[model samples]
Target: MGERPVRRSDELVELLERYAKEDGTRETEIPGLRFIRASRITEPVHSVYEPSLCVVAQGSKEVLLGEERYQYDPASYLTASVYLPITGQIMEASPDAPYLSVQLQLDMNQILEVIQAAEQAGKPKHESGRGLVVSRLGDSLLEAVLRLVRLLDTPEDIPVLAAGFIREIIYRVLQDEQNAAMKQFALLGSRAQRIAKVIERMNREFAQPLKVEELAEEARMSASSLYSYFREVTGMSPIQYQKQLRLQEARRLLLSEGLGAADAAYQVGYESPSHFSREYTRKFGLPPGRDLQRLRETLGR
Candidate 1:
């Protein structure tokens, strides 16, 4: 496929235009399904990605995880198999066409049930521990997605048909040749799953000092293996991951809670305001107060 899809993208554009019809993200009657519309290119926005499928109907996007970048448009779809801190920007959009996309969140139960019933007991392909991947949107997957989106117009039929369509979509994704990353995380005791637990623990306790040995013991991996696989799946070391979580939370505190810089720093486990300010500036390209002002102005519009 090329930069623009012809028939499929047209249908999606029509549905999204009617359903969303707004400038920001719109939640649908269907749980975990959302539509996003943007009239222009955007600055980088940071957020944690839950397990979900993301597809664009009329634009392209770039998602940054650690130092890795995943680019997708109408020709491809992206899946996040686990929770990940990511930065995303709309690379292509304008008042003429606008950027339109849909996201459907999924859980472990869905993936596990589908893979188990399919009897795909084989181990994931080697070196497929990454938590994020972009796969070409083949006909089968695209058709299934279209069916799921169509349910928005007939909420009456959704109760009976949505689950089946959702399962069918997952099944199609699992059948992909490069679905190893998704499979690894869904399979029990897989390295990726173990690392996922570590992520959960770290996210829950980001304010707590990182203990590599403790995380290693919990994941049943040596500190060395833990470091390697953690990077393999998350694209960063455990400490680096925790730092991002803390910084992101600190930023949120400053923005939403009206917390001062020092208060926010200590709340997120920073011992020194100066150190926190330095790291904050390094990561976000501004000091705390300046960034807060900038964010406020951005959101005010």
Candidate 2:
């Protein structure tokens, strides 16, 4: 039994390496699951992380959430229990052993269902914690993940079996020592859950001016309490969080829509082109035009 999980983990790594043949992210036939491959270390990529589980089967990666840096490799897994703006980089890779990983987006409803079914005793009282966490990956969880990935090769089994496997994976995560953080996302009315609602509102209305009182109301907390809890979970104040979302969207506009700096800035709710440029440079380490050019060259676009 001990050897079985190790063998399964090896098999999982081989399958991920084989399927992820290119140097970019790829979506599988299964919903909410994606694969990433990188033949070399990558530059920092800024984006919002949805509720998801990220497991590296080979190599290593790092994610920057607010000012905190989280590094993980094959021995561990990263989880984002809420939507968060983050910077991610592939820290180790090579042509001989490319980085291979899988990201599974979490469905909150499914997570709640798993928790209910388990009906575990003495569930911990919810406490505020960062939504992003790295936890030691255990053999049981790895075995369940291996089974889930194996189904990709046999597409016919996916419809009937994928849900069960995914549920098992979530169950494993919730039962782990890091369950407190995961519970924030699953338990109703937890501070993390309340903040998640506010985050959703921000993402949906990012272009509009932010009002802390409105956000506080949305989260059902007083403004001061909201500020403190928001900072606790996200490592940033409400305004800073909104700025990250805006800047990330502005970058997307520049790259995907081919918008000029000023245009992208205004489109994403920045009123001052120069102000936007300053913040953009500060966040991405390059002025908007230069950053876009570099990204284009790197992507060969």
Candidate 3:
């Protein structure tokens, strides 16, 4: 009798366990792919989820996008087709089993290349959808992911083979049932793509005060249309999105650069320290000073 095939999930768990030794994200030799392992349940982590695909091989995670909550496990994967401010927490983990996952950042140029080469069907016109999505994982997709992970063991083979494997993985994602949304996200002139451009500008200029009319003009849409489409893609108005980005950057400055709360606020374009403190407290459930203290304590810094 033939030997039984190894389950994809099992293979992924083994590969990740062998490679990942720490509790944070580890950059692999393969460009755009990272491995994450955490040994214990974690508090909510606020960060930007870039255009990427995240797959869980063990344990589960919950991600909060605006008012929406998405939970995924070994049987599902999360895809963010645009930059998004999000809160994520590991829902299930422990010392023995831990949480193992892989994050592959998506490249728009590569996605467009695949679409053009395949002559893929165009997406039908529809209302803009949220940029973040969770889809059930199929066996074929899981197999492709496993192959990509396996390439790490042979670093010499990576340069020549990684690109083709990565392309195949993305092709599998494009073939998912949610392909319509993905296609819209990549199409050059779609409203979603237009809104994505506006988001790019916001990220670059997040420290500045927002100008809604100017952003609408940049997107070539009416102010109201920009508002609607922006909210549809990001789950928040442009002002709210900018505020989130500012606050997140302020927190990073405080923690990573050892800046004081008031200085951090000023650095992120907040004019009133009191107003910044209030908003920071409201968003993070702790004042900036206390939050920074707790983070440092937890990180053993």
Task: Give residue 75's error in model 2 in angstroms.
Answer: 0.5
Off by over 4 Å in 2: 1-5, 121-126
Best by lDDT: 3
- Model 2 over residues 1-301: C-alpha lDDT tens digits? 3677668767877998778878899999889989999999988989999999998888999999889999998889999888899999999999998899989999998998887888852357657788888999889888888888999999999999999999999999987777576776677887778888898888899988999998898888899999999998889998999999999999999999989999999988989999999999999899999999989998899
Sort order, lDDT high to low: 3, 1, 2
Error of 3 at 251 (Å): 0.6
Write model 1 residue lDDT over 91-142, tens digit each, in one string.
Answer: 9999889899999998778898998899975875574477888999887788
What is the alpha-carbon lDDT of model 1 when measured against the actual structure? 0.89
lDDT of each: 0.89, 0.88, 0.89
Model 2 per-residue lDDT at 168:
98
State the TM-score for model 2: 0.96
Stretches > 4 Å off in candidate 3: 1-6, 125-127
* Pairs of residues clashing in candidate 1: none
